[model samples]
Target: MKDNKQLAGPRRDTIETFEGHENTILAIATFPDGERIATGSRDKTIRIWRLEDGRETKKWGVKMIIGALVISRDGKQVVSSEGPELGDDEDDDEDKVLSRFYQWQLWVRDAETGRVVAGPLDGHTNSVFALDVSLDGSILASGSADRRVILWDTTTWRRNGDPLLCGAPIACVRFSPAGHGQLGIATDKYIQIWALDRRERLAQIKGHTNYNGSCNLSLSWTRDGARLLSAGNNYDPVIRSWDTSTWEQVGDPWSGHDADQHIYRIILNPAGTLVASASSDNTVRLWQLSTGTEVARYEHSDDVLRVAFSVDGRFVFSGGLDKKISQWEIPDDLLTTARGDPLSGRLKIETTSFNSPHKHQRQASAARGKQKARVYISQSMYILTVNQNLKSHLVVCGFMITTSMFLRHF
Candidate 1:
């Protein structure tokens, strides 16, 4: 299972590459069937792909940059958290109103047609960074840079409650996957668990921070909803978890990921024993949840932004700054390798495959600080700016940004 199927080796294989995203891939969500996936890119389009042959199935052009994406449990809807493309001209009041119109909005689209069924579901005044569907598909929770968590009724696509205020910008939000009726709200230093039925914070666990203080970037819930894990950026380059039922710290912080690099996501496998982390260190690292051990790692050419496990837990798909979705099959002896010993995870693809030669050249140009591009929108005169650094490649045209636009993630 070498990177190239033809290569003669027993290493884990890179099975398929889902290509088509024109910009940095910001989000990826696996469909219920496990054979298809929906990915959101800074390209402002969500493309659905069939995993078998990496064929594009459907695409939806969105008005704003994608922040995060999640599919309803029933697989009938695709809900995406999108942020605004900032405008330069903000001196006039009329222009101000127009700018507010485009800021962080949520869109719920029909899974089959990719048509907007409901939204510009607006409530948060700032960029929405996270979105998660409840276990029953009845509640949709959104966390935002505005430092709030808002809930909406899936049945009516309407806000269900007032915003839950936090001390800092919310980096991620996830409903307990175990049907525990709890929502985990993550910020820089705290992971608060709220009881959905009571609409009150049930538990608040703090004190987990990385070298640079903290910037919690993502969260994951165990399949049984017993453990809630949180991840932060480079300075705080470690993953910490809590026992949901007791609201107590679970284990020693899991750390073999390179320091001073953002762990964009840390997704738990369906079995809930393995943790696959997508990192800015240009690699996807797998860890054992029970022992905090580095089991396997997949090398990527550029910063890895997102990671997702298939429904059946046999394959792992990752997408990122490379703009390509690389599918890696889990090693056959996932749990039995060296009797599940240390550093046995088996992916070794080094260079990333690009969709076009122009993409390769653009990246080279970017390294030399001469790369730039634009997306024309006849509706407004905002000029899109290409990100040229370690953070997300976001669009900041002439649109009005009230708070001087924050970094794409933090």
Candidate 2:
């Protein structure tokens, strides 16, 4: 099936807008039922919204800026974390001495009743950058700036074991999609798979170079738990798929973006055939998993910090520095268009032309040599002109004209 044509659907709609955040939104989490959307902002608050109406359902204030957010698998709990803060001092000498104590807290809340269920989990000694919940909703995993990953029992609200050690700050963490006791972790340059049952490092795949300061931004397990994907802060953005059985790199890295775009998040569609990436370049690119080919690139005016696919995988919700939540529909037709040749299939290029303020007319003159020609499509007509012909071009370019039209349809 050639998925080349743009999917025909309603234009994107603004579902809801939340006010009160003084800074950019950092992270967002959606409930399993798709009824509630939770957002963590630099304003030190987590706001819950009704997905249908975009109305503010609830808001909880934290002491510091929240960097990560996650909802439990059962949609009954939420976990949020703030970066570490400084301690208070009493005397002048004590105040002059800086104390470097770092702390992370996880707050579990009831999704429907808006009640705090468990904590303020205070275990990690640094900023909590990533959080994930198990399929059974009984286990929670957290990655932190202190170079550790921790598993917590959701029911008992206790640590599962000694924190999984790492060489660098853990940037992302996720549970296996098969509902098994397997987890994935990403740091600066390594992707590590750990077995939850044995509490042992299963495999570590390392080859990619790390960005100077930023770490890998996202990790996801394929639906069947047979593969894993990782995206990060390199100029050559890669979507690496690894076999779950042997933990080997299964295929070539998906590389299309040449600009130094940092991928902030990656989510595989429920069908396991499509993968979507939210990036720093203010766009979301969707790719086919089997072929590692780009399907569509959704553009935004500002940086896209996070993105999530609906449970049915028909719509994508993206949030970013713009402080607006935009919903994009993934039409079957657009997917069809993307699968075909973009350059030769129904080519459409929109351009603008402005004539000089002065009006002038020149005779039709022919150049001596036949040079390579390029076609420029304006709003109304196709401009078949040579680049080096100066006298003919300068004489007739005097009127300022504006036009708007489509290129082709078939």
Highest lDDT, which number?
Answer: 1
The models' CA-based lDDT, in order, is 0.69, 0.64
The alpha-carbon deviation from the true structure for residue 406 of candidate 2, after best TM-score superposition, in angstroms, is 42
Clash count, one per candidate:
11, 13
C-alpha lDDT (0 to 100) for residue 110 of candidate 2: 77
Stretches of model 1 off by over 4 angstroms after superposition = 1-13, 87-102, 210-212, 245-248, 335-410
TM-score for each predicted model, relative to the true structure: 0.75, 0.72
Query: What's the residue-level lDDT of 102 in candidate 1?
Result: 46
* Candidate 2 lDDT: 0.64
Candidate 2 per-residue C-alpha lDDT over 303-405 given as tens digits, one digit per residue, 9 for 90 to 100: 7888876644566777778776666777776444433312211222322334411111111222223322222222222221212221112111101122422
Candidate 1 C-alpha lDDT tens digits along 1-410 = 11222211223557789888898898899876456799998899999998778899998998767988998765678999887655635565786755664477898999889888998788887777688877556788998877889989999999887778777778788876544467888887777778777678888766355345767788887654657888878877788877776866777888766767888888877545688989887778787777767777887888999999876566789999999999998786764442332221121112232222121111111121232322211111111122222122322221211222211111
